[model samples]
Target: MADGKFMTAAEAVALIRDGDTVGLMGGGGGLMEATHLFEAVQARFLATRAPRNLTVVHALGIGDKKTKGMSCFAHEGLVKRVIGGHWVWSPAMQQLALENRIEAYILPGGVSSQLMREIGAGRPGLISHVGLGTVCDPRHGGGRMNEAAKDDLAEVLTLDGREWLRYKPFPIHVALVRASAADEDGNISFEHEAANLDAPSLALAARNSGGRVIVQVAERLPRGALKAREVRIPSAWVDAIVVDPAQRTSYDIPFDPAFSGELTGTARAQSEAADHARELAAAQEAFGERQAVARRAAVELFNTGKARPVINYGVGVPDAVAKLIAARNEQHRIYQTIEHGTYGGTLMDGVLFGYARNATAMLDAATQFDFYGGGGLDVAFLGFGELDEEGSVNVSRLGGVTVGPGGFIDIAQNARKVVFCGTLAAKGVKLATGDGRLRVLQQGAVRKLVKRVDQITFSGPQGVVRGQQVLYLTERASFRLTPEGVELFEIAPGVDLQRDVLDQMDFMPRLAAEIGVMDAMYFTAALAAH
Candidate 1:
């Protein structure tokens, strides 16, 4: 490459070759903005198949769909495999893989970053205790390599009662990065870009792997002032720079990916615009004719004197639920905690760094588990992939691959009331619940809430032992899991009794005396509009 001319994002990405494993710079907290670079990767991937058998490591998201970035990456099947914390908000990639549209693997975000570091630093693999005893647990196969992916997942092993995962060394051919500012000499500054989880380590990884490192900077500042204090990635690690002055011109740092999406994408922005209308309608419907009955039922469900204010939210409805709880003036009493450095925002490696709000207490994951182990959580609102007759919830294992247990067990074991939220059945299964009835509009060969789950994300035996309350909330009805199984409770107003609720499941439980209806707010405001 000659020195005189600047490279456009499109031109710079032309350097990528097939069979190359690229180490990207963005790791969520806006470390260096990866959009320009990620877009370039997409452009290159879509134009031709030259860069097949590629590997990716960096802040991860699909960009379109319910999750950000899916519109580009997941839509194009560009993600053969993904190794990061999660794209919880963007489940489309996982969906595609589950349906065999593409290949995918879910890994611990921190571990993914570590593995890249190992590869870049010319090391063999990474060792950690994070995924032990969970799906990441090697006993279940440490992790799977996607069909189109080039590298194998690291394996887990135990030495002297201590467990670790072994990821062999791999070569990196390219590194895509985002930076705050840079000088002519190639020194990079992430100045305020602290939100990127592990960008600093990634730069070294690319350089260590003998790969070219490309930086996408928001602005170009004079080279001299980017002293050691400001310099995050030195010029030695950088190969090219794509300066885009039209963007906001500031590194996103490490704001929560959810917040970042709130700022960047269109679907999220549309939802934001509809927030007021949704809220107004939700309030109106909630306060409508059946509202009192619903409220009383909702209250009685949690009227147990043992209930606490601590709140645990699954990834799907977390943003809305947390905001609802907070806006309801309950953040103070309700303990809002996520399984990370901060709470109240979605966490996906490289996507979100931390929530904008102040986390009252920040506990190391282990200590946080201590709270979970003791059954300290008052209620948990989470998403579910499927449930069986035994009332077992599956959120961990999806598709044919695995996304090891993150903090699901800890939360499930400790939370008093665990609420699973999502559409009742997806894909080929069309479902509606009403009048204690289950109706199948388009019969699926499979039911998401099954007689038994393939692998247990949350244990029914454990829930029984703790005598905690559990609820599975869907669009049409709610299933309350008692010791005997799930008892049919509230039904959507227009829903039928036998067709919508009862007939759909494999098992039948004794009806509970009372079950509260979901608030109309989420349906009208969040769901209908979003």
Candidate 2:
């Protein structure tokens, strides 16, 4: 961090070698913006004769197979492989990768973070009480990049007495991270930056692995300037530092006013709650339709005709779904119910849960995983994406590549019957049946469902084996994954089978049930595609 040692973003990046695994920092547009630094390094590597086998890692995004903004490495065919927990990878990244340009792998957020923790601890890998007997199971190799990834995941071994999911160890050589501020002594302070994203954990892991740790900061100071109490990252672990003084200008985050052109909100996520208050009000108009579907799905899931009703739920539709069950006096169809508690529900909360709602109880993250891993959760409802002829849904990766598995594998595995509540092929696409009564179009077309998913957020294999009926609720049609391709169940009124459904998709699906018309109240909101 000495003054004279400073170099341009391009100069510092030249230090990286080919095939080196670099740990990057910063998740969304925040204080730790590593994009510019990476771009500079990538450009240096690409403009000259460089090694193609480069590995990049980060808490949130390594931009997967494609890189954008400042990613000369991702663009010029310099990077060979990439990995991350969340997929916010650049969409064009995977296409080039699939074309043999780079190799990519996506892991669950929590699991991936934990993997880095295990590395820092010097353990080969950590055993998890999460994502077992589900899509992320090592048996399927955790949906690794390719043959090599399969081998990396193949090392996991489940303990017989107590069930848990385990993954192999990954070594680290270099790390690229960002910081809000740092002092000459190396005491770092996030100053509420911890909540920004997962940079701290990635940096710790990189340092513990004996790898060279390079950090990008907004400023540097004299020897005792920053207080020890304010330091987030200690100087002992820091190897090199690069400073970018301005807030968003020196490193612009497009979505943030602090960084970028006129455009904002990469996914409309930052300040989404405040910015889209009007949208939420509109979504409220369709509350009746959502509530009705929730009630029906809940009743069906509750009345199993056998066991005591113990239910578990997820966010979004499941929150509304649980409300229906509660309306029925916790019906005989249900006894004790649980939810991830993301919505403002006064229900029992579990561990690792964000608890956006005022739930009855909340516990440690570890305890939540215990219930999830123990296979005690009953029925659940959630969201999803495209299901191929093989029934593989690519809900994980998208064009912007902000794909994820977030606690999905854990919930799906424990639930008896999982209800995936989402519209199918949204974009004014519609279908009709039943003497022409109901009419509707698809809404919320997620971009992840391509010919193949960049990552598997949910596993169709487990759904089929568990007798799980996947319901894709669209205003126009309801599609379910069968042993064959996804089968269309019913269609809305004013919609045609031949014109709307079949025409949009690149592939054909099994026609299971004759399309039926939905109710009248469902047509107010026109379904739009992402």
Q: Which candidate tops lDDT?
A: 1
Highest TM-score model number: 2
Q: How many residue pairs collide in each prediction?
A: 43, 25
Across 1-530, the per-residue lDDT of candidate 2 in tens digits comes to 34544556665676677777776654332324465576677667657866457776653433323344214455544666666544433555555445545665655544655676678778877687455543466665464544334334423464666656566667777767666667766565543221323455566677888776677766777778887666766787776677766534222232232111122356334433343343334334434345434533554574554477456665455655554444433434454433221222323112212222222233222244455556656666766665555556555545433355545656665566667765445445443322323334353344323455445556666567557656655434567777665777766556666755566555676786566555533443332100
In terms of lDDT, the poorest run of 10 residues in model 1 is: 287-296
Error of 2 at 33 (Å): 3.6
Question: Which sections of candidate 1 miss by over 4 Å?
Answer: 1-7, 24-33, 44-49, 66-103, 114-142, 145-154, 159-171, 183-194, 224-237, 248-312, 334-380, 389-392, 395-419, 423-447, 454-503, 508-530
TM-score of 2: 0.63
For candidate 1, write residues 138-232 as lDDT tens digits: 45444542444334466767789765667556676777776667787878875434244355566677788777787777677765967786676
lDDT, residue 127, candidate 2:
80
Q: lDDT values of the candidates? A: 0.55, 0.52
